[model samples]
Target: MLDIIYKYQNLLANIDEYIEDSKFKKEYLIEQLGVSRATFYNKVKKKSFTIDEMVVLSTILFPEEAKAFEIKEALRQSREDSKAGKTRDHKDVMAEVRDKLRA
Candidate 1:
């Protein structure tokens, strides 16, 4: 759960960086994401977003950053799997994460 919370915060920070670097307004971003202002705010506040929603936002907002984010997420998941005593290949987990990111 803490990992998820951290991931959520990191994702938000990445979005903020993109917005700042590109001088892109949040309103425009929300529009591009097809999410209303209120809905966007609510999702951020609740930290409740589906992977598909996140992929859409990342792909639209900062495609380059999305690659970095996917790599980080894959690493984190791999660590978690190891911690849980799940015997799985890190490469396999990374492949799965990559597949999802591509989707």
Candidate 2:
């Protein structure tokens, strides 16, 4: 439960940063998210949102940010798996590094 909360908080924080960086107005975001201005404000104030809402907002409002979030989540999962002794093979590590470099 705590992990879920933390993940939501991180996503919300990232969304806020993206909004600021993109110079998006709150009214625009509300419209994009298909919510009333007051509803959007209330959700932001309470930091409570459904996972579906998050995904939808991320997908439609800021696709680049959504991709960034996906990458971040992949990296986090890889780290956690490594910590649990699920480390990848050396060749896999090299391949991943090469892919990153190529990117």
- lDDT for each residue of candidate 1 in 1-103, tens digit (9 for 90 to 100): 9998898779865654545566567787678778889987777666565677777777766778878888999999989998999776889999999999999
Candidate 2 TM-score, true structure as reference: 0.46
Candidate number with greatest lDDT = 2
User: Alpha carbon lDDT of residue 71, candidate 2?
Assistant: 99
lDDT of each: 0.76, 0.78
lDDT of 2 by residue, 9-61 (tens): 88787765655576567777787778888888778767666787788766766
RMSD of each: 9.3, 7.9
